[model samples]
Target: MRVVSLVPSLTEAVAVTLPGVLVGATEWCTHPAGLDVARIGGTKNPDVPAIVALRPDLVLANEEENRAPDLAALRAAGIEVLVTEVRELPQAIRELDRALRACGASARPRWLDEAETAWLRLPPLQGRLRAVVPIWRRPWMVLGRATFAGDLLARLGVDNVYADHAERYPRVPLDELRGTRPDLVVLPDEPYRFTPDDGPEAFEAPAVLVSGRHLTWYGPSLGEAAGVLATALGR
Candidate 1:
């Protein structure tokens, strides 16, 4: 079965679930090495021509990741597309299950079971860490209320502090941070790679550089990340 995965996390998970099945993926879909597959470009701007050339049996995408124009184009070409949108951990597992079933691939229901077991083992979040999650660098975009990242943070027992704001992602002015006086400021990697030393001197606090995908991605891999982050948080 020829399959093209547009989302990076699915690119990795699909490869694991159905090894030697993926035919194409976006440039960012690099994991489970030696893929060396065809690149169909990024999420927002897809290489339509290259993807068309692949002539895939199934095109796997994510609603929040891929742009509508690309999806419309693929559908216009009569391609069978499966779009997954995951807001929470369970939804992600369900989406993966659905994708596996659609592809006629070998996907066991036990993946969800194992994932749940892993999640149940993590310690509940205890302290309210005043944290800031930066999604971008220039102008500095942060995860606000109603975003997946904010929900994930809440699940992990850490409060967003910005949860009261209505925007999903809001850019805060540097001067506004002065009053917040965060206890732990988290800089997520990708979208931007932030280092502990890069923690601005204007604020006196302990900051941590974390993996964005690990903290925010709601996918089959979330259970793995929960354990990792829980350990990191020493919970």
Candidate 2:
């Protein structure tokens, strides 16, 4: 079955699981380095015509990462689009299983099982640290309530200061985020590509750079997320 994936994490999941089944993917879907698939475009603004031209049997997408209008356009063109909603780790695993099955994967990949075991085996945190996780700068957007990143951090004993906020991704002033006085400022290198020279100096707390794929992506990377993120957090 031919598949075109718009979500980066799902793209990696399908590519690594079923190899040549992935015929097309977004430009942002940069995993399994040396992936030689047709580039459709970015998550927010995918090239509908280019994707339709691929003649894929299934199109993988996410409710959060992909734009609604693009998915609608794909469906209007008679493409079978599988939209996955993964708000947390458990949901991500379940949804990935469903997506793979829908795309005609014969069996569950070992990475999925490994990812589950990795998270489940993580020792309970001795103490929790209050944190403010900033995803972007300039305007300053942070991980708010009910975000996958927030839940992942919570599991790692890092509590997001704005986890109780109404919006999942809230845009707040830089001074307001500093006002929270978090113990640590966790930074991920995607969406905005926050780096040590760019992100850390603004905050009073020590900022630790983390792999965006581990912190955010929900594919094979999850198997190593616990260990990698723990080490990055200095646990």
Candidate 3:
């Protein structure tokens, strides 16, 4: 099947499971390094004309990552579109499985096995730390409930102090973080790079800079991420 993937996580998954089937993808839907697929703009604004020209048998999208109008237009064009939304890790695995199945793929990598093995090897947290995971800077956003990053943190046994908040990725005030008094502050490397001088001195605890993809990207990459998180959290 010729597929156009609009979601970054699903793009990574398809590139891993059904590589040749993916005919086009969004520019930012990068993973499985050096993917030479056609660029369809970002997650929200896809190149509708280019996508239509591809004449794909399927277009993969995500409810959270795509804009409604673009999807609506595709559907109105009588195109077959599959939309996947992942709130947690398990759902991500399920969606990836579904996407692979749609492509009639039966083979999967050994990463799932590695992930299971890593999960079993994690040690119990001596003292779980409260952490704020910042996905973006400037306006200052933090990961909250129902986000992939939050789920990853939960699996590592670290308490997400912002999980109680209703907003998924909310702009947080620096003062609010001070009031929370997190034991650890996790600054994600992408979207924005927080430096040691960026409010670290004001923090009450030690901070760690981490790869956002390892903490947020949910797909075949999770196996590698599991190992990284295990090492980071001493899980």
TM-scores across all candidates? 0.90, 0.98, 0.91
Reference-based lDDT, each prediction: 0.75, 0.92, 0.78
Tens-digit per-residue lDDT, 1-235, candidate 3: 8899897777887887766888889888768799888887888889898899888889998888888899999888878899887888777777777777776678555665565456556666676778987776667788888887887788787888999898888889878877888888887766676667764565677787777678877677777887787676555
Candidate 2: pairs in clash: none
Of the two candidates 1 and 2, the one with more favorable TM-score, higher being better, is 2
**Against the true structure, what is every candidate's RMSD?**
2.1, 0.8, 2.0
- For candidate 1, the lDDT comes to 0.75
- State the lDDT at 86 in candidate 3: 83
* Model 1 TM-score, 2 decimals: 0.90
Q: Least lDDT summed over 10 consecutive residues: which range in candidate 3?
A: 107-116
In model 2, how large is the Cα lDDT of residue 40? 91
**For all candidates, what are the clash counts?**
0, 0, 2
Winner on TM-score (1 vs 3): 3
Q: Write the per-residue lDDT of candidate 2 for residues 44-159, one digit (tens) a residue.
A: 99999999999999999999999999999999999999999988889988999999998888778999999999999998678989999999998899999988888889889999
Could you give the candidate ranking by lDDT, starting with the highest? 2, 3, 1
Off by over 4 Å in 3: 107-109, 195-202
